[model samples]
Target: MEQLLYITIGGSTHTATMVSNAATEALLTRLKSSPVTVTLNSSGGFEIWGALGFSLPATDEPVNAQPGDIVLYNGSNICMFYGTNSWSYTRLGKIDGLSESELRTFLKAGESNVKVTLSLSNTAGLQSVDGSVAKSNGSAYTLSGTSACAGQKGVCIKNKKKIIR
Candidate 1:
């Protein structure tokens, strides 16, 4: 199934349709634990780019990125376009339901240190490995009866209560 990723900037949230790839998979795994916030700066009069503070697998290819395109650069940085650019980048996803002008305004084009938070839309209908419904128990845990750490994903137990991270 196609996954939707949410990007929030300046109190407005936008959705992106994620591509099915190792890089995107890794991103989703990270977000399952917590949202990622990056400080981006406008660049080349075309895009806002920044470091992700972590690396994802890169399968770079030549791409003529258009407005709303989000791509991974050098395995660690993220670039969100508001204009145009041609480069070798790992395709991440594209922001949905916005026009060019709206994208520019939403991205705060030409601005520096713009805060962008990436998260997963609330996951519904999630099932555990044993085909059980998942719930929250105030704390998170793993299905193996262990505590779910900050970076762990999947079904977990919290005080013996089932939860999905």
Candidate 2:
């Protein structure tokens, strides 16, 4: 099943969905525990990090990504963008109904760092993952120790692929 992820940053909440795959499965499973909070900052045209220490499928990498695209970067980072990027990114979902300028305003809420809360939403859609079908739900988690990763640009892997959150 395709599920929605609610990202609350500052005063705005954006919704996104995941592409069906084992990687996405692993991520959804972690989400059931609680919503994951990650410290994020603006970089280039996107807000990167809030690394949930969650891993997912590095499946499809779109040649280019537009605003409101939620993507898995480097297999560990969940990146939401307000601008365009070209890379092999496993697309999680896109934020619906936000105009381009509105998205930029949301992402650029601040220049330093901002905290984002991610939780599974009530809406769902039909999708496939590893040839299996099951219903899944989620909310948020802790971001108590990832302040160190907040100021940096791009996803930084620690201890050989660990996000160190």
Q: Compute the lDDT for candidate 2.
A: 0.61
Deviation of model 2 at 123, angstroms: 14
Clashes of each: 3, 9
The sequence of per-residue lDDT tens digits that candidate 2 reaches over residues 50-162 is 56576666785554888888888878887788877888878777877788888877666336566777777421121222112211221111122122234443322332232
What C-alpha lDDT do the candidate models reach, one value each?
Answer: 0.82, 0.61
Model 2 lDDT-worst window of ten: 133-142
Model 2 off-target regions past 4 Å?
60-62, 122-165
Q: Mind giving the per-residue lDDT tens digits that candidate 1 earns over 57-132?
A: 9999999999999999999999999999999999999999789999999899999999988988522212343323
The candidate that wins on TM-score is 1
RMSD to truth, every model: 10.9, 16.0
Index of the highest-lDDT prediction: 1
TM-score of each: 0.73, 0.65
Query: Least accurate stretch of 10 residues (summed lDDT) in model 1?
Result: 122-131
